[model samples]
Target: MECTGEQFCSIIMDNMVEECVMVSILEPMGVVTKKVKGTFEQIGSPQQYSLCDHHQKSLVYCHRTMELKAVTIQGGNNRRARFNLSRYSNASTTTTNQALPVVLGIDQWNLSCSKQTDSATPVLQLERCKDQLTTIGAQEKTVRFLFYKNTTGFSLTTFESAMYPGWFISTSLEPSQPIQMCQKQDARKLINFMVKH
Candidate 1:
């Protein structure tokens, strides 16, 4: 499942004109309330955070409807993924809600949805999958990503498709569609973003 706008809050960087998906980390005391703000272009920039000292053992979170939700990817014959909205919480308001399920859209580069249908679920076709994400109308292949945190905060650092290298993860114009991997020179600059709350 691609991390598009369906589950994530997409923010466009003013200066660089790049859009990044907002991902959060689950903290023990409560969800980390600090907001991560920075541009991927400036790798040397400092991040402002208000997180706890123990920032370990955290899970990936997706921001939806101003609330932070937990993300889970299913295993086994059914490669389904969902976000637990029941655990939804508002860091600023300090409010919690009942847990609900949001189905993930497995269209290689698209985000997940709340619909409970098979067509809504994306199928990962390894052999038929495209060699690059940028190539649309390719086979369906779900991808795993690698995130890096340098001097910057916990934003997306760098990512590669499951079977495709030299091609990195990226988003296209329509947020409803799957994100693509491009070979263009600026593709890296477009995807190597910081993930913050």
Candidate 2:
């Protein structure tokens, strides 16, 4: 069933539901968190001298919230073509151009954009993967493009270059929706597509 904007907002407000959904969504998207695994040792005396040793595995925790800002459908199609989510803290104002991370899940294929749309109001796109030849595994997968707009004034190219030395030169693009392309694969394709389009 399709989720309406209201439903999306409700889901975001419900922390329990959001956590569960995010875990399920991120897994198939190949966003795996670092898993810490170890054992425990016990050495101690009976009464006074007792040492309790324990080993714990730390799992990466992902915290995400969604605020439904707008909903748009493709031309002549009833199916929703896009949905926008505003990611902001409680103290954040709507008018301010704040960079928020968006995770886009299109069918099975998932891509993240550092900024979805520009600083122009918060919005995101959920588009279909019409081109099956893009990637082998991506054919049957639905495409979701997460967008973020870095208003911090620091260019993504600069940051990515410093952060990931061997990475390719990052490019910029203005998608149908507001999104900041970041993923290595998506960034390359988006830049090329934007240039040609």
Candidate 3:
């Protein structure tokens, strides 16, 4: 049940989702290749064993079919203060939209296609601000999802490094109900499930 940081990072980098049971994960980047049968003359050469042009087309087709499912969760603590002064009769009135403003966050997230050579499962931990009741006033609020090795409990800096140029957010739900960190497979499944029900 426990895994080291190195082992965990390898799994995440490799895009292996089924190793972890609690969470259902999917990688859109997992490309499937097919062998093309043809003579050296018909094809190009035996030395080139990579997927044929047709095979590459098919792989791309398959990858596009299993991309991430679209999910939108909206909830943010934002407060606005307004003041109005009237010149006549010294009467002034102010109005405020006290409701918690919701923003469309995490429209889509895809899984990595790379495979993991190691056998460790990756766990994602979300960190949020401590002051939940108070509005996030004037300061930028950030949510961080940390991928850690379950056994060693060490952070995978390499995995973090690989995630550059991509956007992610932290979830406030329990580990089992981590809607924020839904993997590609689970996201698709959940979307389908929601549609059916």
Candidate 4:
């Protein structure tokens, strides 16, 4: 597909799909590495995003703590560039308001959560870059994220690990606390975030 200035496209996997757009390179965008037809193509480009926590206000990366933290943001804060987002390609037949596959990144690193260990809840962390939606046979990557959107007239979204479906990315109500995963039925309001593209 022709991507010209923020088109609605989903690159769910490493390979291309029918509904997926070409925006491959995440860090530095607009520099086409390969030649498709002696022209430049937008390959793997990542759009900088700021996730607003419903309760804590701001979801940011704590450089000192080396992890994501929840705090107050006034006037968009100064850490918007710390996070980036891209949608994973989904080839579903029906176009319901269902959760779409996506990949969350902290700059160049991709967000990932391991499967529950010893029945313990999984925590979200940034790891080396990889196409999370890339699957082999029946095995899906742990780096994949499920993007859930709430259509209650507000742009609220939640990121759940594809490895574990019900678990979501959450933050603490108290400021400066680390961000982790929580259950859907949890009474906390931190899971729902307003994704500012």
Candidate 5:
């Protein structure tokens, strides 16, 4: 998982680009008017994290997707090595939607999913975004996923696709298979992972 998007985040020298504090005024109609103001994001940084399988096998980028491999210190610049972990937040709009959904970033590509692939099944995808988000709440919807944290006080985590709910990010029991999106009801498949900082 080589990090290719060097321009992913511009190193900011001032607080101006990192955050903006201001006032807001709005009037929907002559009968209703209101004023509101607070802080807003102009750009957000992707915080780093590392992901591994339940067996602690590091995920490596391969064939435009992910596969299992031994954790390596030389994770980046190797092309197929696991590298460049980041938390790419999902857009927060509708109140009913999960708050701040997450899209895990492997290298620069997002850990995305599609309802159907050439095999006509849900699968994981490494999608490169054409338009980088300039705000915190703006996200690529197709890449969004919901995080399921372990309740027993472990750093373990699992991800389920936001677009197609109940489909989780999973890998085959057999080694070397590309990661796939498995149904929640599926009795087989490895979905839980160890997410580390």
Candidate 6:
């Protein structure tokens, strides 16, 4: 099915406790990476997005921290010879001014939280260089996941972290356990959603 870039999306986990993904808000501003049942509204025009919930609360949009750059080696023995290296370089990373994701009526509006202050948010960033969506900072070793077509069926899609390719996003009943990357020999993480929209 084709999306018009304005449809609400539900990121459902195949084996999560709540069976939905949510932008959880906790004290000190914490984002729940674990999957929970949630109704996410897709915001932003064109292809860019800022997710919103049923209560009109928009999810935090974590901007790109560092950008990849190709730097050429200086002082080469041969004038015609040059070496190239791809690396992450610090850049101007900022977040949107929209209010962070809140459960509405539960937590009051918070204005103190800011990306500049290093507060946590529910927005996950997709790093184009490595082709991974990172929940944490855009560090190389941070918790990063990859989106790909389902192995069994080409039409469906799923998320799998590069660190743990064998495991897919899953959830547990316990709050301590929450949702996590789980490994199942016969399981497939494939699901349908408008990733671009």
Candidate 4, residues 1-197, lDDT tens digits: the string is: 56644343443343565586787522211111121121111226556777877664677776666687777776746764356666544342122354555566775676777755575777677667554343311143543343333322356567665556566787776776777878766665367677776
Error of 3 at 192 (Å): 14
TM-score per candidate: 0.23, 0.19, 0.16, 0.63, 0.55, 0.23
Poorest 10 consecutive residues by lDDT, candidate 4: 27-36
Model 3 off-target regions past 4 Å?
1-120, 127-177, 180-183, 187-197
| Pairs of residues clashing in candidate 6 | 20-36, 20-37
> What is the per-residue lDDT of model 5 for residues 30-136, given as tens digits with 9 covering 90 to 100?
11011111211332466665666676556666653344343433445343344343333322323223223454665556666665545656656666766453333
| Model 6 residue 32 lDDT score | 25
- Expressed as tens digits, the lDDT of each residue in 1-197 for candidate 2 is 88999998888788554334433311101121221112111112112111000111111111132221112323442322232222212122122233332232333333322223555222232334444322222112221232222322232211111111112212233222222323345522221111000
Q: State each model's CA lDDT, in order.
A: 0.26, 0.25, 0.21, 0.56, 0.48, 0.24
Candidate 1 residue-wise lDDT, 1-197, digit = tens: 57677445543333355569888842211111222122112122222221111111112223233221122323431222221111111122211232111111222322211113555322222122233322122123222211111122443333322223333434333222333344325422233433322
Q: What's the C-alpha lDDT at position 176 in model 1? A: 26
lDDT string, candidate 6, 9-77, tens digits: 432333346546787532111122332222222222212222221222222221232211112224532
Candidate number with greatest TM-score: 4
* Residue 123 CA displacement from its true place in model 5, Å: 2.2
- Comparing 5 with 6 on lDDT, the higher-scoring candidate is 5
- What's each prediction's clash count? 14, 18, 7, 10, 1, 2
Query: Model 4: what TM-score?
Result: 0.63
Off by over 4 Å in 2: 1-75, 83-97, 112-147, 150-197
lDDT of 3 by residue, 1-197 (tens): 98999999998889966665586533222111121111111112112111111111100112233222222223421111111110111011111111111111111222221123472323232122243212122112211211110111121111110121121212222221232233324432221111000
